[model samples]
Target: MEKKIITISRQFGSGGHEVGMKLAQKLGVKFYDKELVDMLAKDGKYNADFIEANEEKCSPPMCPVMPGFSMPVFYQDLPSDLIYKGQSKLIRTLAERGPCVVVGRCADYILRNMNPVNCFVYGSLEARVNRKMSMIPEGLSFTREEIKKRVIDVDKKRAKYHEFYTDKRWGRMEDYDLCVNTDKVGIEGAVETIAAYVEHCK
Candidate 1:
């Protein structure tokens, strides 16, 4: 029983990234996080930062208005939309290459057809705020309230992105094969659970 591919969709401050990385280490497989964005940016059509901004969130890719400006009639596809398409192809390609763990960027939805292990990581708002507060850089000034707001904001963006692209509700239990609450099992435990789930799968 080999873990061919694992895709993790997570809430903003839920330690999802850490879990994915650790699981990859435990499973001895390649891991893709921001690396996916870097690969997508290789052709130079989109920079790492640009892809980071629009890749995970829809920013309403199909909508004419998103954030700073509106798409003109001449521009058929928005930046976010193009980035999504690129990442979809890239994620699938990477999965095809070998076993790997991919974090965020809707990898689970993108890799759905591959029969990959799909996971969702999440925690309560207070738990997320606490975890996020500790991760903030030293000397950086940010209140717990600020961190909480940021967590909320990021989750909203992710939900929007998932729904727009997959036509499925984000955080919906049925969509994911496994859901872990970091508030309960913690990061390491979540990683172990996901790894075990992968092992349990065909």
Candidate 2:
């Protein structure tokens, strides 16, 4: 049987991870999300905390002010750059290993040569906020406004990270093989739709 790889890129509050997991299960394949972080940390001998912090974040520009003049600063390496390299390597390695569903970390771009099916999952802001808030545990106490802000912040970070690493706009429909609107189709519907697309691709 030919191996198939599915890469899911999602908006912050969209249940993309859940959809990816369900799709993988329905297809009898493995799922990779936070597990990619762990694999990168282990394979690259990087600290887990550092990898978690730098993953999907763009490093701030460094500027050093000098007395009477500003000196040009050139950076050989940044933590975000290192993390991206490690994670990219890990993503490609995993693609080579077998069929699986990988979420985020620019897996789509990394596995371009493997003919992975790239998917983008998104939802309306109101729908996303409601979904996010529902996931909070009881007594966690996050207001709707707070959830909205968090969703915005995360989406911004993800967009920046994608542009920085892949030089491509994130969430653009043209870049993905499929774009699922979870708010419109619901999670199960989105999963079924993507599964059908994957089958057709094979």
lDDT of the candidates, in the order given: 0.87, 0.89
Task: Specify the poorest-scoring 10-residue window by lDDT in model 1.
Answer: 58-67
Which tens-of-lDDT digit does each residue in 1-202 have in candidate 1?
Answer: 5867998899988999999999999999999998888898997888998997777776533435556665544456777789989999998999999999999888888888888888999999999999889888998989888898899998998898888888679999998899999999998999888877787797
- 187: Cα error in model 2, Å: 1.2
Q: lDDT per residue, candidate 2, 96-178, as tens digits?
A: 88999999999999898889999999999999999998899987898899999999999999999999989679998889999
Q: Which residue pairs in candidate 2 collide?
A: none
Worst 10 residues of 2 by lDDT: 68-77
How far out, in Å, is residue 118 in model 2? 0.7
Candidate 2 similarity to native, TM-score: 0.91
List the candidate 2 regions with Cα displacement exceeding 4 Å.
Answer: 1-3, 62-73
TM-score of each: 0.91, 0.91
Q: After superposition, how far is residue 34 of candidate 1 from its true place, in Å?
A: 0.7
